[model samples]
Target: MPEPATRIRPMGRRAVLTGGAAAILAAAGFTPAQAATGRSAGKATGEPTYTLTVMGTTDLHGNVFNWDYFGDKEFDDTQHDDIGLAKIATLVDAVRAERGRRNTLLIDAGDTIQGTPLAYYYARVEPITKQRIHPMAAAMNAIGFDAAALGNHEFNYGIPLLRTFEKQLDFPLLGANAVDQRTGQPAFAPYTVRTVRFEGARPLKVGILGLTNPGIAIWDKANVEGQMTFPGLVEQARVFVPRLRRAGADIVVVSAHSGADTSSSYGDALPYPENASTLLAEEVPGIDAVLVGHAHAEIPQRFVTNKETGAQVLLTEPSYWGRRLSLIDLDVRWSGRQGWQVVAKRSQVLKSNTVPEDTEIVALLKGDHDKVVTYVNSPVGTSKEAMSAATARYEDVPALDFVNFVQAKAVKDALAGTADAELPVLSIAAPFNRDAAIPAGQVSVRDVAGLYIYDNTLLAVRFTGAQLKDYLELSATYFKQVTGSGPFAPDDVTNAPTPTAPSGTPDYNYDVVSGLDAPLTYDIDITKAPGQRITGLAYGGAPVGADQVFALAVNNYRQSGGGNFPHVSTAEVIYNRQVEIRQLLIDWVSAAGEIDPVAFSSVDWRLVADGTPVVIEG
Candidate 1:
């Protein structure tokens, strides 16, 4: 994903061969080392052989300070307690200790910020004191983050802020794809050659290049569109891989914030997560391995052979917000053309069940965590109706409406006096906090946080009628006709293909949009193209315009594209502010007690043309 913003797969907990994943680690033929840990890289090495232990995280989504919102006082999810930076730091230190100094490198693929409440709090109020430092960066700096790359979410705060972090960060931020809005220089260093000299012998040069999905223009239009341009992710990787080799990089590892979507098509075009066509290690001369992120899902296999190259490409992604840390051990054999070629690789999962919590780091983030406690748990306005995020599997939902209501209101609240306030606000909401239906009952602050576990702000993006069609096309990716009736059958993204098993199973794949009146239907064949599925669309009893400009609201992630919607890529943000929608939900609850159930039916669709399924625009 060369786009400034970043993007996932559907992965959840299953019975772990847990110990084998941790205790019985395999590296070519070596016996597993005892558990202790804890760690980026790319290229054709031209120098010497070396083994670089790569430890990585994707979609940390600002879980740096642990989670104050999901505290014991709120609920007993336990997902947060053992899954924050403090715990990750402990594991990282131990891993490095075993590998020894200079042999280990810590890198992040992308999506590091904007998840937990502490991150939101720090972004707005915290001071960078001698002791009270910027916790997220402070923790990364403390944990010895060797390098990191950007995610689309990074732009949610805008380029000025991103540059500020880039300038102040202690670790080098590398990226081959991110071009500066002003100078066209690589936004961060394109790549960095890290030299590790053990026993003062010849130093081993490891070249690390980072790539972010280039779709940032659509997601963060206000922050990046005019200021920057993404040349192209795959093409950029093609150009940079060789450049690293020429620069004398012994071992190369790519920290890609991009992704390969499970979806095959969008509108009439192929929807790719990052550089879908590019498989660098297999296609390029000197490249060895790649660490991927932005999908926020964990992939455990050591190697997924590239079909095109017969080259074994090693890829790893951990769960977002500190739920998991991925460790990849690369067995590098020295070569001449490329100094060190990673001949073998293996990965492990550091989960809460296997690893105990690191108490010290918890204490460090406690005060900041306390502030987080006050922010989310503290009562805001109340709701007279029950605003439960509870909904059934694969169904149009009210919780989504709840999410939309709060987010839209938050944007309106943030932009109350600005000229942009005149524009109608629409929020794009998704179900990250999916669970079996919420029993009609009292909703706590933590519960609201759970409704949208990812800490995201509200943003308003401007889109023309045509752009809206593209956006819907992207949304349609989640829905596919099961009849094989040319995939043109009626569909909703939330439903499971197979009916419920005897196990009374659940499917959490659905996403919902709210704020517009609807009686919408997509009767046309969608899979044929964008205009196909949307057989019918209207907002408030009227056909949508080809030229109408919409004031659309979305949580920072989707606006930044966690779901891969189209035209959303061209979002010209009319409302760009730092108001968290979760807090808005708390306010909504206090004002009304509970939300009366509200359904966010589809309100718009693409027009079919001549049975060819063409979606027309202004």
Candidate 2:
């Protein structure tokens, strides 16, 4: 196993806090209590209070620069937010300067490796395991991170690559819950204790316990099924936080890759809730603050009181893609008998857009950025007409059809001369990016990649007609119920709130199913309730029989219990080539040399209310 690079060592009483010395002691066979006493301490003079600021970023998703590879331009949004570590470096420098460099600690929550084309290029095209340092590791090492929590997406490229990325970092990737399957012991370092020095008072020990989401068991089942298991965040924190306290930590802060909400996307597939950062705060007694992640929502500050201890725990989550940075400030007072105790705590999110890109980071990553830009812009094929997925959430469009077409074709081709070859193939796709579009004339890799944003692989499963109907019914819940249609807007009828998605169902969860060789048509009756919304289901102009079995082409995420979709997870998998769906689309376009949607496009589904076709304006 690779050792964590962030482990600090003791260098007398006036030693500066550079690494995880307590972890080094533990590695040297010292017990938790022994490690606590191993730290050098100074004689306390008076009750002096000091402020410690913890700066945090989460869900960076492979952004090193503000440029978007898919769009071939600098990233911009409705809020004019800036992205990437280059901009975050500027904000970090400003914070370190204002707070004094020695008093502040820099950390991250998770999702560091996979998102943009730069990450994909490194992970797949030229793997970092082949002796090349990952750009994320290089940039983060340059910025000097103390530690980071493990995210569920860290397993996207499998374990070997993850270990390589971990070794290249200057910080430890902490995960108390990610344990070995057989031993039931933590596979990674549970927590790290850092000593913050003071002149006249005793040094403050800050314990950072890293907790990862339990959904990794479901989302990355293929990569870690037999090797490891992920327990709940609250469950593992209960075991580690007390140990951290016993390790003589003056203050305990949790950097969790889970969200502040108590919702699970996988719905009972695992015994634990997916987003349990608040539960960790409310249930765990010793924690003083929490850095939340995974939900990608902005929360300046939230205080959850512990039910048993009556102490308030602070929580904050910076938005994803390095757009925001979380600033958590804690005040601690030193005493003769009791040592150090936290007096007050608060947190807020700082916008990276308010600052300029740090020239140091920009210059360091310029070569890697330019390589990805060139790769994505390289022409793959030509298109006969333009296609857009702006309104694909509520309407049938060729952009999504093109995705299903390529996926179903690939599955069918893979199953040729096999037992599943005779079965009819159906494909399912989701509108991942609302702004994804394919322009007329020559097409590039970025055009196809934008259509399928996730790093999902394709798989084929056998499902009965009844199970297929149930799947469609579950997907139909994405739309809100309506009476007589008066040309309602798409937004007014789409993204209905569900138990899993209390803040409206995301576009990725609203799947659109289509037939490969024939037209499979149906109507989602918005007038009806969920489970009864899917009506007029037919394949090849005839009603689908409940016992009819067909091969369904689906993504690995959906097949592996992502979004809690019905029937698919338990279905019998017929084909599993482990092929990435995005690469398939790009390869198909490259071989064909033209993207003429007329060859495979067909309107297979529509929205209706009381047997009347619903008109969706805009």
Candidate with top lDDT is 2
lDDT of each: 0.57, 0.85
User: What is the per-residue lDDT of model 2 for residues 1-618, given as tens digits with 9 covering 90 to 100?
Assistant: 332232452321121222233332222222332111111333354455677888899999999998888889989999988899987776666555545566778889999999999999999988886468899998888887888999989999998889889888867789999998888888888888777775555767888999998988888778899999999999899988998887878888899999998988888888999999999999989999999999999988899999999999999999999988888888777676777877667777777775667777778888888888889999999999999999899889999999999999998998999988999999999999998999999999999899999999999999999999999999989998888864998888999998888899999999999999998999989989889998899999999999999999999899989999998999999998878999999999999999999998888899988888899886
Write down the TM-score for model 1.
0.69
TM-score of 2: 0.93
> Where does candidate 2 clash, by residue pair?
7-20, 8-19, 8-20, 8-21
CA RMSD of all predictions: 9.5, 7.1
Q: Stretches of candidate 1 above 4 Å error?
A: 1-50, 65-82, 125-132, 260-278, 304-313, 332-352, 392-399, 402-429, 435-493, 496-618
C-alpha lDDT (0 to 100) for residue 193 of candidate 1? 68
lDDT of 1 by residue, 295-335 (tens): 66666544656555577767767666676677777666554
